[model samples]
Target: MTTTLHCHMPLPANFRADGFLDFHRRDAQQVAERVYEQTLEKGLLWHGQPALLRIALQPQQAEASLLLDGASRRDDEALLASTVRHMLGLTQPVEAFEAVVAGHPQLGPLLARQSGLRVPQTSSGFEALAWAIIGQQISVAAAVSIRRRFIQAAGRRHSSGLYCLPDADCAAGMDEASLRAAGFTQGKAQTLLRLAAIVASGELPLAAWQFAPDAAQIGKQLAAIRGIGPWTISYALLRGFAWLDGSLHGDVAVRRNLQRLLARDDKLEAAEVEAWLAPFSPWRALVAAHLWAMQSSDGY
Candidate 1:
């Protein structure tokens, strides 16, 4: 039986719609919509079950309405709400991060302009891991194109005509050849399939971390997998489990933006970037998000 539920969540303080609006526009999973308010629609899995999530953002009111359609259990209402909150970064401690950056020479002004911005999370850890793998050393546009093809190949269509990102089991069933055909490099294809198998077999336990995050432990576990590195693990933790401390210095955009922020003429080394972000600890990912926003925001 189909079930529908509605939930309302308060937006973060000084919430800017630009990040969410840009994300909604760029996301391959979502249907495009724009009017007085913006709406993002996508198919996702809840406890291995399919459902469609529609989130409407009203920037003027600084609030959002989340609707879940096709849920199998009315009991899932709370869990569904929590998931939506996590996906949209509703629970991000933006104030805390801002406080940490307040009055800073370089970051202060940037944070002022980007007050309510947050990094939108992936629907699942597997999706985050898969995306990190697919995105390694590639431009965002290339990664998006490959991701679209990958979703078409491995994901299932929902009643809403949107494809839900493949769950671990479904992803595990994907062949490397199919992934290669979908534009994944040989290493990336192998790595993704291996990760899916590990997760599907319950060996990796990606879901457990979301509830009780142990970043070091999870990082060690993911690092054991071939082709998974510091950046991949950090990215997955930030996007999947909402573990905000992971260092993203290795990200090209983060470094480039940091260089621009500092008005440096020379390229920065990865170690330098890592050292620069260390002071922000526990909010490193948030800082990285700000750096990303700085690159995206025009007239900055």
Candidate 2:
């Protein structure tokens, strides 16, 4: 079913799929051709359902029928339209995105590269928190493998290829035996299930969090969780909120990129990179995006 709809949102500035989605979304391997978000709720929200991409956006015509399905299959026309509008960034002012990337040199280039950086805010913070734990001290490939296993076991696949990650109820009963098959270490598996238990019991409000926190506050809250910490929160900021200024203080890649960009050795201190990147305030997320994007393309 195709329905013509008008888009009130501008095309986002930071819209691209340079393998980041490979790690971020479950349907990535077979269905990553169309995924995006607005910058309002942070980049935490993502479009993982195949229904989201079914109706190809007719850019030249700017008019076409939307093929809505997936997690949103049951939604009415109004809701579908709203979701489309939001997805295409028609709801928010493009000006806000401009303001975010206007001044900073690093982010300016990145914003330019990202095409349109509009991502809606609708992330499962707990899922991302779990992801961080699963990924710690592991290669992205290894992390993704482990994650795929865990998600497959717990999450129910929705239409259009979106997997609404399991909530506390589904996760509470997940024992170490099941997770070990998913290739998780016993310790890692225990931490994840325990985290899910707390969430299911309402002891931890993993899904409910705000984006406008001071660094310390964000760090503190995430660290309080058994499996989350500074690096995890920063990651959540990137994957969950999609902050333009979000950068991990000690990320190895961030340091290496900064050093290489500065003609320094590959071992630049995290502090130095932070100092150099501080000027791009509020847009560092975009800066990090650019750096990661660059690495994503040319291994430099």
Candidate 3:
């Protein structure tokens, strides 16, 4: 039987569907199915059901439509809507970010150039953690290739030819050889397994981090994991949890963008980046997003 559910979500005035799609398509070549100028498809586990979600933007309109091809239960509509909202960051208002940008001469122009850009969120913290681990110390292209292999090996296959990212259970059960065969180095594979095990065993509460009082505490919990570092946790908080205060001071791309924005020849250290970002305070994540958007022409 074929089941279909449709939902229309209002987009914020400044939300750019193309920018978000560009960002999503950049590192998701293998792990996600996005057809530019058309639709984006992905597999999501919603309320214990595997949903094949396809989203398309309504041209010249301040809204987008979501189609869930595999969802059967009517009750799952709320969960599906929430998932899409979280994924696209539609729930967060950009006015405050625009205000912050208006104060900064360097970042202000970006607001106009990439008006509707939002930081895309991963379907789950587990997926975010997996991507973080896979991307460590590797170029984005190489990381995407490895992630595609890993997903094919462990992700749940959908009839639509899309794959739902593996849950903690699937990841925890993966052996070192299998992960290594997926292009993971011995150390990275071991780290992935260890993290998956911890989450699966309830030793590490991935979802609970959202309730933590501060990003620092979340950082502490993630850092305690075997291979997760400052950069990984920060990136996860920004992209996974949609934490607006999260900054990418330690991220190479952010640093490079900062240099370009400042027109400086010398690379800025983490401390320097942090110092410069202090003024942005609660909107630092938006700053990072703008910086990433500026680098779109050069490839992120």
Question: Cα miss at 25, model 3 (Å)?
Answer: 2.0
What does the lDDT read for residue 282 in candidate 1? 84
Report model 3's TM-score to 2 decimal places. Answer: 0.87
Order the numbered candidates by TM-score, best leading: 1, 3, 2
Cα RMSDs of all predictions?
Answer: 3.0, 6.5, 3.0
Model 1 Cα lDDT, one tens digit per residue, 1-300: 566677767765566666666754554444322223566666666666666767777644333333344445655667667767787787788888888789999999998888878778776788889888988888877887788888889757666667777889888898999999999999999999999999999999987677557889999999999999999999989888888898988888899899999999999888999999999998998898888887773211
- C-alpha positional error of residue 289 in candidate 2 after TM-score superposition, expressed in Å: 1.5
Task: Output the TM-score of candidate 1.
Answer: 0.90
Quantify all predictions' global Cα lDDT against the true fold: 0.77, 0.52, 0.72
Worst 10 residues of 2 by lDDT: 38-47
TM-score of every prediction relative to native = 0.90, 0.66, 0.87
Q: Order of all candidates by lDDT, from best down to worst?
A: 1, 3, 2
Candidate 2 per-residue lDDT, tens place, 1-300, comes to: 323223333333344322323233433443223334311111111233322222233333122233333233343455445444533334434357566656755555555555544432223556556777787777666776776677677655534454445545666777888889989988888777877777677765544443333545556655676766566677766555444456565666667676665666558787877787787666555456456555652211
Runs of candidate 2 exceeding 4 Å displacement:
1-123, 159-164, 206-219, 243-245, 297-300
